[model samples]
Target: MKFPQYFSLLIVSSLLFACSNESDSDTEKSGIPAVITPVPLDTYFPPITRTDEWETVSIETLGWNENQVDNLYTYLEDNDTDAFIILKDGRIVIEKYFGDFTKDDNHAWNSAGKNLTSMLTGIAQQEEFLSITDATSQYLGEGWSSLTIDQELSITIKNQLTMTTGLDYNVEDAFCTDPECLIYLNDIGTTWYYHNAPYTLLDDVIANATNTDFNSYFSEKIKEPIGMQGLFIKVGYNNVFFSTARSMARFGLLNLNQGTWDDTPILLDTAYFNSMTNSSQDLNLSYGYLYWLNGKSSYRVPGSEVEFTGSLIPNAPADLYAGLGKNDQKLYMVPSLDLVIVRMGSASSEIQLGPSGFDNELWGLINEIIQ
Candidate 1:
């Protein structure tokens, strides 16, 4: 959903590469090319002047089933969902808050907020504050990690963005930010693991590079501009974001429009936007900068070394990409349908860091309604 134009550009480049390599007849494709259905650019971005003035559309108007509405809510409520929303062309088709949770109540994004950090990094890079290729120590300074100067210097922002920093995950606490906890596992870029220490350090890198606090920079660049009402809180070693469900949907809308808020270009670096949402590393085809991509040939989930052999969510759209959190918080977008879906709540039962069994089960239920 982030880049329809980039995928169009990719198709052109891929055709050239596919023809040039006689050896790459079948297995060596650059990207999974698909005919992206045109997203409706006429969609409205909710104004910040009145935060409560978002537009709405009915599912019946979109030819979705009314009978299944009850089924959808039933599943959401039964599974401990606090809020759920489905947007078509930036207009709400369904928005519901369960139990004591209201539309304005704040819920933690957990790991889904990693998408917010990824976007801010892109914005920072576009403004020339930093480059992803630069050694992380350039900002974090030497000895930020237990690695030697040379070893630490070998790690780049791109490595951290792609989860290929080769940081040790076999620790007593993977979330620990101390230098002693960041032991070197393999050579930089040679291994891929979802180690949080390297990722959490990205806040320091952004703060040092931009000469601004991460939260301040985020507010100035993204939150205030797009009418988003959210704040990042330092929780232990991580900076987790919290916002109302509607604010989360606003971000989903922004991403659906390729990092734009109406006519204003919030993140106009098309190349960086493309890279942020597409495959950033070969080791995990389903991961972008911090987003979970779908429709790739294979994908590896968090905390697991084994690679699964299919799309991340089999019941969902092939082009769906998402920001998934530890407790089943989800932000999913499908460009073909001009759709953005967000779910924020407590975990269905246990805390899982996404691509969980609930994803398939929920999407299976959603399929019946959307169809």
Candidate 2:
């Protein structure tokens, strides 16, 4: 769960680009036609204070044998599952739950929310909130300007999304107070480190450009259109969402379709989807726009012949990208298989602390059913 915290006003500024095909326009290659009228900034929803209304799905005919489904449920029940859902070829293949979780339960996306954060950056570019090429200096201004000129020159929205900010990779700096201590140390796009602070800084960029809180902007722009009843929780100084497994699956489904939700084009451009799922950083070739990719480039458990090394679950598809959270929350998308798998739970033991052998195990079972 991300808490919305205070941000330094020291940043850069840029004028909103018209979503045009001009040389300066960021929307040209994206092919999502430019908007005639920019979306109003005032439409943003306030921090969630009302009761969350859930979208209901009646599940009676997914066709899995009750025993088989029960076996999966039993497995999760024994392991602390809050919810799990599987979508095959855009259809709900299975949905199961245990341990105080329900269809309406709102669980924090934790780091799982990072992908959504990245996706929103693309969406913001599509809507002309800010261009992808706009330097970080444009939004983060004089406060950031105090840094060495070369450091200021290297910062961009792309670096933030790709986790290539050239910042230090120290876990102790997870929630650093002084942004200056974290200076740009390498080429902007050349390095990759799993830094949450830079990623979280995006909320300020989006909010500053759009003139609203990140939660409301995301709710209006992303969740509502897809019929996802999710909320970006803002407690004290952090902002994150609490969503049900089904809704998380839907978010993955949106990615599986390359940023389209149903017939509506929420992302405005699918090109952003391509670059997002594919590698965006050189160091960690296993990560995309705030989303983690499984298979070849990733580190796997020792002596696991499952050979999941870089293989996205064939049952789940090799192109699968996931939003992984602390304590075992996952929203996985497989493009070729047209599948989305969501799991939300607390870890029963320290087992989830490493490359979960469970992912390989779960795929082993799901493959049998798919075959």
Give Cα-based local distance difference scores for all models.
0.89, 0.67
Which stretches in model 1 have alpha-carbon errors above 4 Å?
1-41
Record all residue pairs in model 1 with backbone atoms less than 3 Å apart, i.e. clashing.
none
In the order shown, the candidates' Cα RMSDs to the true structure are: 18.4, 23.1
Clashes of 1: 0
Model 1: weakest 10-residue lDDT segment is 32-41
TM-score of each: 0.88, 0.74
Q: How would you encode candidate 2's per-residue C-alpha lDDT over 64-119 as one tens digit per residue?
A: 34445555667777778888887765555577777667978889877788888888
**Candidate No. with top TM-score:** 1
55-89: candidate 1 lDDT, tens digit per residue = 77776667788888898899999999999999989
Supply the global lDDT for candidate 2. Answer: 0.67
* TM-score of decoy 2: 0.74
- What's the TM for model 1? 0.88
